[model samples]
Target: MTTKNLPIYQIDAFSDVLFAGNPAAVVPLSTWLPDDVLQKIAMENNLSETAFFVPVTAGNADFHIRWFTPTVEVPLCGHATLASAYVIFNQLGFEGDIVRLQSKSGILTARRYLGAIVLDFPKQPIVPETIADDVIAALGGDTPVETFGVASRDTDLVAVYDDATIVRSMTPDMSLLAKLADRGVIVTAPGDKTGLDMISRYFVPAIGINEDPVTGYMHCVVAPYWADKLGQDDVVGYQASARGGVVACKVVGDRVHLTGEAVLYLKGEITVSA
Candidate 1:
């Protein structure tokens, strides 16, 4: 039996310290592999997300990146993308401060900002909508002051609470979240803490994550929404998960720039049968 050794790096994204943010596995592939193999690798890692990237000679893009959870391949993942950019800058000897990756969500770019990585993502449009009774019940039965439907991959429901405490104290029903079919739930509120503009928590059981410690994609949706609601373009958001993290967001036109720091946690090799 022949085997191949692949380089893998585990990184904690959206936090400068270890074990404080979302951990994502990043595998640098020389070429594209089978989709099933990628899924299997992600499943083996068992993290919220695993990122795979291959160098490309395409226009204005350094690589093509893809993200997968334990169960399925997701269209967009902010933490994993930030982790991949960290690898490119720190491990791969990339010279430029800006790294552009082409993904299913369109061309995403990561740049250095004050010793942190800033991600450029499209602002997910969220519109006020009626939420189902069961979904509300799944959110601990405390009705949200507002419910909005998200127009983005992975995230579907956005529930706005009047207080940050309610967003932080939610004990959601994972079984109900799993029924959302690849969609995730987001709960957010105005920040009561100093230095924070908003707070949020993400539940995405449908895509294999019951609770994401720090979700950048969720901030992309919430930051813009809060910007419009609060009449500010720049906002600081904190994810009140057990492994809490902070995201600095700036909304410009149709784009949202997310800034956060990542730390490398583990560097190892995975042996896969060829």
Candidate 2:
């Protein structure tokens, strides 16, 4: 059988500029695409992630959403959710003022607030842990004085370095990173150059992304950790990834709210063989 045609939208999430923020391919479908096909599409697109959406009605509200990377399906993705909401609200001309996503993680809601999109996500608090030799080798850094694992997946490794430059300048070994058991590693330090509370860089070679341009999920854990340390709930975050982006973060109860703007970059279609 011939493959059906699929529509795809490339959107830059968490930034207003075309090149800034994370670029995610949004594909809205009537039914869920096969996992293999989705991965193939993501690999073909070669973006950090590609989001797939399908409508679901539960109890009182109707929801739509799903997220995928080139290699695997993820439980949650902040930037892609922002990109999906952007497409639903602006491109599809969705009438509702808010969009709710029923994802593998749970129900997540996004709404327009003060010209920026705000996403309410679960707060992931991780306690500091002993740094392993392999983790340090993957990061290409001497053993950090302190380390923390964020969330249950242990995808985020918060390593505190002495200076911001040390965190920014170090070149990591992706091959070694892929061998790491965690989903991703995050190296961070107090920002000396900027007035922001802190600056960080995220690498996820294990999941097929060498470095994520801007990571909203990591901030879910970072925002809370830094908030308590700095005695402030609201703060700014800078992802030191090559194609970096900024995020405004706030911690509310058990949830962390991340707000940012997204820009539409490329629009195209995909033809998938059956």
Candidate 3:
């Protein structure tokens, strides 16, 4: 097996501190790596997801990027996207403040806005639906006072709780959560403790994730739901996961804009075996 030095960086997105938000590994590569190699790197990093960026053109503005989890590849991921942007802008010595990423989903742009990185993402809207028994079981038997279903680029389950604390304090059965197929669950409520407008937690055990530390993809659905519920297009959301994260969100027509900060944790090199 041959080896090459691969640059990697660990970044905490949606948080200003070292360990608060989701930690993702960003690997900037010169060319596309083999699928097995990418998966193995993600598994070795053992983070929620790792991002790989390949330069589309030398010193050009855009690059092709892909994200992979230890188990599978994801279409879209917010924290890792943010982490990738942080690396391109701060570490790679790119001249421009804004960078464009061409992903499996589509083109995404990130820029520094209002002292934070604002990401413009496609909006996922929710329609009312009945809750499945398994969903209720996974939620620890606390029947949602109201349930709304949303299918955007991804499937989302939005369950409203009485308050934020209950959403935060929930202990779900991961075994039952594993039964859910290809859908992400969100338990959310109006915030009483935090200054934020609402708080929520995300679970995606079906895709081999028990609990996402900070979910930006879930926010795509959450922002629009609460925007209508709260009668305001702009909102502040707090993900109550153990690591926790904060997102400043706004609903703009059929799109949602999420803004937050990120901190780079580690920078190193990897030798990919060939």
Candidate 4:
């Protein structure tokens, strides 16, 4: 078999500092490759998400994008989308300020906003759910202030807390949570510190991520929820995982503007054969 050298980059999204935020692998391609190869590269990179993009010729968007986790292909991902936009604007030497991507979730736009890169994503409809016992038990016995179901997934649920400390100190049973109906349990609370309105942590061990450092996609649901609670459209969210990250958000009708900083971590080449 022949090998093709592909340029790849690993970027830490939603943080200005290195080693913070979530790291995603970005692979820009001129043509589409086999799905198996794309999945293989994601597994090889071993990150929570690897983003692949091919420039689109049609009108609605600038490029076609896809996201893959170590185990499955997620419908939408925020950090990886941010990473992809970073590549397009800074590394690829594009002069434009915005990059629109057509994704499985729909058309998502990433632009430079107030010195931070921003991603415009569809807001998920949040509906109150009957909190389950296992959901509370997964968080080590701290019952959330409330819980809701997100339109993003049939099994995705959002749990709100009263304070940030509860979110930071949570040590959920990843194994148990994985088996629970909520495939992605988003635990969030009001930010305790200055310059932050909210804080959150994401656990989706069933899809192979136990705790996502800074979840960009989850914020689509979170931003709207907080905007309603805070009675404001602009808000700041800090994901207090081991590797912390800050995402600035603005809730627009049916959309959320997700903004954050990212630092380039590694640029390397990967060899693949079809």
Point out the worst 10-residue segment of candidate 4 by lDDT.
176-185
Question: What overall lDDT goes with each candidate model?
Answer: 0.91, 0.82, 0.85, 0.89
Per-residue alpha-carbon lDDT of model 2 for 1-274, expressed as tens digits?
5678888899999998898889999998878777788888888888888998887756533466767788888888899989988888888778987788887777788988877899988887788776678878778856666788875666567787767777778788998877874578777777666558778888888888988888888888778878888899997888887778889899999898999998888777888985
lDDT tens digits by residue: candidate 1, 1-274: 4677999999999999998899999999998778898999999999999999999886989999999999999888999999999999999999999999999999999998889999999888888788788888888898889988886652488899998988888998899768843478889999998999999999888878899999888888999989998899999999999999999999999999999999999999999874
TM-score per candidate, in order? 0.97, 0.94, 0.93, 0.96
TM-score attained by model 1: 0.97
Off by over 4 Å in 4: none
How far off is model 2, as Cα RMSD?
1.7
User: In lDDT terms, how accurate is model 2?
Assistant: 0.82
User: Which 10-residue window in model 3 sums to the lowest lDDT?
Assistant: 148-157
Clashes of 3: 0
Clashing pairs in 4: none
Model 1 accuracy (lDDT, Cα) = 0.91
TM-score of 3: 0.93
Q: Which stretches of candidate 1 lie over 4 Å from their true place?
A: 180-182
- lDDT string for model 3 (55-172, tens) is 8774433898899888889888999999998898889998876888888767787887766788877787777877788878778888788887776534567888876767988999
